[model samples]
Target: MSASAAGPDWGIFEGRTLSLLHPASMLGMAALSVSTALLGFQWRRQRTIGGEINELKAQLPNLNGAKTVSEALAAAQSAEMVDTSYV
Candidate 1:
C-alpha cells in the first residue's frame, strides 16, 4: 500500500520500505549529533584561545634568547646565596 493513503504520520522510517527501525538507531543518531555540536564548539573555543595567545605574544617585547638568558644568570648571581648547612 502507498504511504500517504495509510495515514499522516511523522517518523524516521515511515515511508521507507527497506528500512528497519530500532530504538538504538535513534539513540545513536542523537549521540552523533550531540558529539558533532560539542566538537564544533570545542574547535571554536580553541581557535579563540589560540588567537588571544598570538595577540599577547605579538604585544609583548621580542627579547633575544641569549640576551635574556644572560640577564637572568646575572640577576641570579647578584642575589644572596642560600646556606646549605642544614642539609
Candidate 2:
C-alpha cells in the first residue's frame, strides 16, 4: 500500500515550529506534562513509603537468633506457667 493510504502517521514532535499553537506541538506538550506529573507523583509516593519503612524499622526490636517452633512453644509455655494468675 502507498504511504498516504496506510494511515495518519503520528510522529512524536513532528511538524514542530517556533509557534507553540501547532496541533502536533500541543499534543507533545500535553504528553510531556502528563508524564512529568506522573513521574513526580511516583517519586513522592516512593519517598513516603521509604519514610514509613524506616519508621517501622526503628520501631521494631532487635532480633537475637532464630528459634525452632518447638523451642518457641516451650518458651511460651514457661512464661504462661509463671503467669497463670493473670489468666
lDDT of 2: 0.70
Lowest summed lDDT over 10 consecutive residues: which window, candidate 2? 12-21
| Runs in model 2 lying further than 4 Å from the true structure | 1-21, 55-74, 77-87
- Evaluate all candidate structures by whole-model CA lDDT and list the values in order: 0.72, 0.70
Q: 20-62, model 1: which lDDT tens digit per residue?
A: 5565688899999999999999999987998899889799664
Q: Give Cα distance to truth, residue 49, candidate 2, Å.
A: 1.5
RMSD of each: 8.9, 11.2
Stretches > 4 Å off in candidate 1: 1-22, 54-70, 76-87
- Residue 65 lDDT in model 2? 46
Cα deviation in Å at residue 42, candidate 2?
Answer: 1.1
**Top candidate (TM-score):** 2
**Which residue pairs does candidate 2 place in steric collision?**
none
lDDT per residue as tens, model 2, 3-74: 662543545433344334577678999999999999999999987998899999899654334256566666
TM-score of 2: 0.42
